[model samples]
Target: MAEWWRGSVTYQVYPRSFQDSNGDGIGDLVGITARLPHLAALGVDAVWLSPIFKSPMADMGYDVSDYTDVDPLFGDLAAFDAMVAQAHALGLKVIIDQVISHSSDQHAFFRESRQSRDNPRADWYVWADANPDGSPPTNWLSVFGGSAWEWDARRRQYYLHNFLPSQPDFNFHNPAVQDWALEVLRFWLERGVDGFRLDTVNYYFHDDQLRSNGPMPTRDNRPPVNPYDLQDHVFSKSRPENTGWLERMRALTDEYPDRTMVGEVGDAAWRNVAIMAEYTQPGRLHMAYSFDMLGPEFTAGHFREKIEGFFAGAPDGWPMWAFSNHDVIRHASRWASHGAPDAVAKLASAMLLSFEGSVCLYQGEEAGQVETEVLFEELTDPPGIRFWPDYKGRDGCRTPMVWDASEHGGFSEVKPWLPVKAPQLARNVAAQDGVPGSVLEFYREMLAFRRMTPALQVGRTRFFDLPEPVLGFARGDGLACVFNLSARPVVLTATGALIDGAPCHAAHLDAGRLLLGANGFAFLRPDGGLGLSAG
Candidate 1:
C-alpha cells in the first residue's frame, strides 16, 4: 500500500518574494521553475506555493478574485502548468494555496452579491442588516483591525470579512458557494496539481444566529495584545458547520489518487489542534498546521508543551510543523538571545525533522535569515499599517529572499516588492553556499538524514522525562533519541557509543554518564540495536 503523507517535508515558497525571472521586481512562476533544482537539492518532497492565483493583492494574494486562473503578475496558466509539469518531473509534488473562506471584492460573485440586496448572487456572501442604530450587526473584529463587517452602500447592509474589508467572506451556507469552491479545486486537480494548502480553514462558517462573542476573562493580568484576541471568537469562526464543508472538500480531493490537502487552522488556542484532529482523521485533510510554534516563545518547556498538547489534543490527526512563514517573526530573530542565531536555526531543523508529523520549511529560513526590519515608510502589510510602532506587521518576514549579496540580493533586477534589508543580505544563499558548516548546509544534511532514517521519518514519538531547558524525546523503531535545548552541559547515563553528524565516531563513555554541551543533543541506541551511522 502507498504510504500517507505523515512524515513528509514541504518547502513553502512565497511566490512574490521567492525569485524574479522577468526582472520585474516581483517573483513569478517562471522564477519558481528556474529554482526547481534548488528545491530538489534541499530534498523536500513537496513545494507549497502561497497563492499564485489572480488577486487584487489586498492581503497579498489571499484576496483572490479568480481562483481558477493564474495571476498575470505572477504568470499565466501555461506557466503554472509548466511549473507543475517540471516539479513532477523533478519528483517534487506541487501544492497551491486555496483561499476559499473569502474572495476579493473584485471577484465576480462578490460584485454580484454586493450589487443589490435581492440579486441572484446576493446571498452568495455573508450579508446582514445593521442594528436599529445602524451599527454592525455583531461586534466581530477583523484580524487586520477594526470591525469584521463592512457596509455595502449598494446592498444597504454589511458583509462579513474576517480579514481585510476587501476580502468578503463567502457564505458557505449557500450550496452554490460550495459548488463553486469545489469547482475551483477541480480546476487545479485537472491541471495535475498535487494538493492544496487551505488558508484560514476554520473560518469557513459563522454562527447562524449572529450572536455576539463574549469577552475573554483576563487570565494573565497582562493587557491584551490586540482587540481581536480579547474575545472568545466562538460565534464568528470555528463553527461546527466547518466540519461538514471539510468533509465535502475531502470527498472532492479523494477522487484524485495520491492528492492531499493541508489546512491552515489559525486559532492560537489548543482548540485549533482539536479541530485539526476532527478535520483530518483518515478522510478529511491530509494534515493541518497551527500558529503554536510561530510565536516568540522559544523555551524547551514551551516547545515540549506545544507539541505534547497537540499530540494529546489531536491524537489521530496528522500535523505539519514550521519555524517560520510569511506571517510572523522568524525564529532566529524571535529566539536570538537564548542561543546563537545560526545554532538555533540548525537545532530547530534537527528537532523539527525528528518530530512525528510532516514539516514545512519556509523560504529563506535555510540561510539563517532573521526577520528584516521594515520602517514605517517601507511597510506594505495592512496589519503593520494599522498597528504601527506597536506591531511592525508581517512585512518583515515577507521581504524578498536573498539569493546572493549582489544588487537587490539577486532577488530582482529592479528593487523588489519589499526592500531586502542589509542584515538579511549577509545571510544570503550565495554567501553560505558550499560552506561546510553553514546553516544552509546543515538544513540539507538534516533533510537528507531524515529521508534516509525511516524511524525519523515515520516513527511514533515518546518524550523522555527531562528537566526544564532540556527537551528530550525518543523517536524511532527501537531507538531512543534525546536533546538538550539549554546552553549548559548535562550528563546522561547511556550504555552505547554516541553517534552524531556525518562520519560518525565512537564517543568514549568514560563514566556512567555522558556530558552534553550547551545547545547539544544526542541520539543513542543500545549496543546491540542498529549501529549508528549518519547518512
Candidate 2:
C-alpha cells in the first residue's frame, strides 16, 4: 500500500506563536488542539509541530532538556495525548520535531555526563581535553557566534555545541547513546505521533578523529551573517556514520503501522542535495529536505536546477520542498522585490504544490503573512541579538498568528510572547476566510486542486527548455505545467488544452499562442507533447 505522505502537504506549527487558548501569552497544546480545524480545512495531511518537548526556552524549544516529556510551557503529557487524539479525529497525522543531534545542557544525561570523568554517563556527550596552551580543542566555530566548544569546569574539558553553548551535541560514537535515542522515538511513537521530523539529521555524527575543517571556497554569492559559514564543515557534520543511525531509526519506526520520518539535511547547496539523497534511501529516512529552495534565489532556472539536480543525483530518493519555516524569512516578503507580495505568495503556493515531491506549508503562510520588522530590544533569537542590525534573526517570521483584527490579533487576549504588529494583523484569518482572490482562499483552492488531480499529486516531472521568466514542465502523462517566474508578462506559442484546478490569473491559450500576464501560471492537458516556440 502507498504511504499517505507521498506527495502530501504537511503544515508546520510553531507552538509559541500559533495560538493561546489560556491567554497566558503563550501557545500550548490545548491551543494547538483547538486549532486543528484550521489544518483540516487547509487540506493538509499532517501537522509537524516544532519542538514542544521539555526545554528551558534557550534557542526556543530546540534545546531539549527532557526528550521523553513535554515542556510545561506547552502543556503536559495529558495535553499532548489529547492533542494527538484530536488531530487523529480530524484526519491529521502528527509529526514532531526530534532534536536528536543535540540536547539542552540541562538534560539529565548532560548533567551527569558533565559531573565527573568516570561517571556512569560521562561518555554520553562530546567532550575533549584542551591543547597544551589551555586553549579550546579545535578551531570550530559555533553557528550562533563564537567557539563551538564550551569549557566545563566540572569535567575539566570542553564540550561540543553546534548552535548555542547550552545545546550540546551528543556522542553518537557511543552505542549506549544510540539505544537511548531510539528509546526516545519509541516513547513518542507509543504516545500516537504518526511520524517524526528529524532535526539536524546530518549532524548526528562527527568525524571521530576530530579533524579541523577546511576553509570554504570564496564566491560572488552573499555570505551568511555568521563566521560558521566560512568553513567547509566536513569534520563537524554529515558523516557517513550517520546513515547507520538512520537505519536504526527506520527499523524502530517500522515497528508501528503507517509511520514516516523526514530528515533535515543542514548543509550548503552542493553537498545538501547529495546528503538529502543519501539520507532518504529506502532503509533510511522516508524523505528529507535541504535548504536549497529556502535561500534568496527566485527564478525559473534556480528552481529548475534544484528539482532536476536532486533527481539526477538520486532517482529513487524522495524530497520534501518548503519555502518558509521557522528558520528563515517568509517567501512573500523575501521575494517581494520581484512581484507584488500577494501575487508572489499565491504563485509560490501554486508552484510548490505542483512540484514532484511532498510539500510543507508553514502556519499563517496560507494568509500571505510577511516577515515582521523586529527591533533590537524586542529581539529574542540568539543570533539576532548577537549580530544586531545586520541579522535581525528569525523573530520576524515567528510572530503570533493573527486570527482576527482585535487586540494582539486575537492570538491572545493578553500580550503575546512576540509583539503583534499592524502588517501581520491586517492579514488576519478572519478577514480572508471567505474572501475571493484572497491568498488564504487561493491556498485552500490549490490544495483541494492538488488533491483531486492525479497527475499533480503523484506525477513524475520532466522539464522543458523554456527561456528566462518562463518555466515549462510536464507532469504525469499529459498535464503540462508552465509559469511566468517574473513580474512582467510573457506569451508563448504552445499546443495544449487548458485545465483549471485553481484559478488561472490573466492566462489563456488561444490559436496556439499562450498568453501569461505578470506572475501568471497555467496547467494544460495537451493533445500531444507540448511543443513551444516563444514569440
Candidate 3:
C-alpha cells in the first residue's frame, strides 16, 4: 500500500529487555535481528527499536552520548545494518527512536558547551545565568523531580534538563544546534531506516525568555507523587517554536522516499491530543502519539476524545496510538481492575487496533504481559529510586521478554538486567503458541483480521452515542466495532452483520442483538453506510 505507515501497525521493541544474544543480561541488535521473524509472525508492518544509540544509560539510553554511532553494548554498526536488513527482508519497516531533544552531558556537544562561555559550542545547550540569590534561572521543574536547571561551575551557568541532570536539553533556539541535529537525522536516514520514533518530541524547544511556569491547581485533595506536576509546564515545554523544528524534520524526511516521523507528545491529558494534532499537521510530523490512552483511564469518553479530538483539530494529521510502552506501566496490569488480565489485554487490543490511525504494540503485550514487580534494590530508574515506595519506576515494564517455560523464560542464559518474575514468566510464548483462545493467538488473529480489513485501516471514524460500558464506533463506511469495557455482561442492538468475535470469543451475537461478555468485543460489517449517531 502507498504510505505504508498511514495505517500501519508498529511493534515497539525495547532492545535492552527484548532478547540477549551475547548473554550479558542485556539485549543487543543481534538479538533483535534474530527476532525479526517473531515480529513478522505477529503481522506488524514496522519495528520501532527504542534507542540503541551510544549512551551512558543515565535514562535507559534516552541520554545519548553519541548521535551517529551504535552503542557497543547493543553492538557495532555492522549489527545495526544486519538488523535493518533482516527487518526489511521480513517485510517490516524499521523505525529508530530519536532522543535528540536532549543529550548526555558527556556528549561531545554538551561537553564543549559546558566549558567556558567563549567555546564554539557554548550556546549549543540551554545555558543561562542564575538568579541574584543563586537560585535556578527559572522555576521550571524536571520530570524526574527537582528544578529543570542544573548548575555547572565550569561555565558558571545553569543548563536546562527536562529529564535527568546528566541529560541536558539542547538549545533548539540556536541555528547551529538545529543544523547539527539535522545532520544527525541525515546520518540515520542514510542507514536505510524507514522512520523515527521521536522521544520527548515536544521537549525540543523551550521558552526563549526563560519564564517560570505558572502553578497548576490540583483538582484532587491528595498531592501528586512528583512536584513537577504542581506547575502547568507551559514555559518548560510545548513552546510554539517547536513547530518550525518539526517542519524542518518533516522536510528532511520528505527528501527520503517513503520515510515518516512519529513523535511522542508528552503533555497533560487535557491538551496532549491537541498538541499531537498540531504537530502532525500537513508539513510537520507524519504522525504523533500521546500519553492519553497509555494512562490508567480506560473509559469510553476518554478513548473517543483522544481519537476523535485529534482528527477534529487537524483533519489531515495522523496519530499513532498505543496502550503500553517502555515508559509507562503495562496496560494489562494498569487496567486489571476492569476485568481479567487476559480479557483486558484482548479488549484493549481490539479497541486500539480498530481506531482510525496507526497502532503500536509494545514488547510482550501480545501474551498479556503484566508489569513486573521490581524491588527498591533492583531498581535502576532514577525517578523510581529517588521516589522509593511511592513510584517503583519503569523497570517493571522494561523487564526482559519471556519466550518460554524454561528458566529465565528463554530470554537469556544468564540473569537479565531486570529480573523476570513468576507473573511475567507464566505468560510465556511457549505456553501460548497455537493455543485456541490464548492471548497470544488472539493477538495473531486480531492482527491478521486488522491487516485483511480495509475499513479498519486508513478509514474515517464516527463514534456511536451508546451508553457507558459499550464503546460503539464505525470505521469507514463498512466496519463497525463494539467493545464492552466492564466486568459484567451487557446486550445491545446489532446494527450490522456478525462477522468476527462472537459466541466463544470476546462477545456473542443473538437473534438481532449482541450480547457482550465481560470485556468482550466484536467486529461487524454494516449493512449500509454507517450512519451512526455522533458520540
In order of TM-score, best first, we have 2, 3, 1
The candidate scoring highest on TM-score is 2
Q: Could you give candidate 3's per-residue lDDT for residues 106-180 as a string of tens digits? A: 998888888789889988889999999999999999999998999999989899999899999999999998999
Q: Where is model 3 poorest over a 10-residue stretch in terms of lDDT?
A: 526-535
- Candidate 1 structure quality by residue, lDDT tens digits, 1-535: 2444679999999999999999899999999999999989988999999999899898889999988898999999999999999999999999989999999999998888888888899899999999999999999999988899999888889999999999999999999999989999999999998899999999999998999998866679776557888878899998998888998999999899889999998874656667777777766788888677888777768777777777787777788888899998988898787677777777777788788789999998989989998999999899899889898899998899899998799989999999997899999998788898898988888888788888887787777666666666667655565555656556666656565553111123443465656566656664432222121
> Cα RMSDs of all predictions?
3.3, 1.3, 2.2
Worst 10 residues of 1 by lDDT: 526-535
TM-scores of all candidate predictions against the true structure = 0.95, 0.98, 0.97
Residue 263: error of model 2 in Å?
0.4
Among residues 3 or more apart in sequence or in different chains, the pairs in candidate 2 whose N, CA or C atoms overlap within 3 Å are none
Which ranking of candidates, highest lDDT first?
A: 2, 3, 1
Q: lDDT of candidate 1? A: 0.83
* CA lDDT, every model vs. true structure: 0.83, 0.90, 0.88
Colliding residue pairs in candidate 3: none
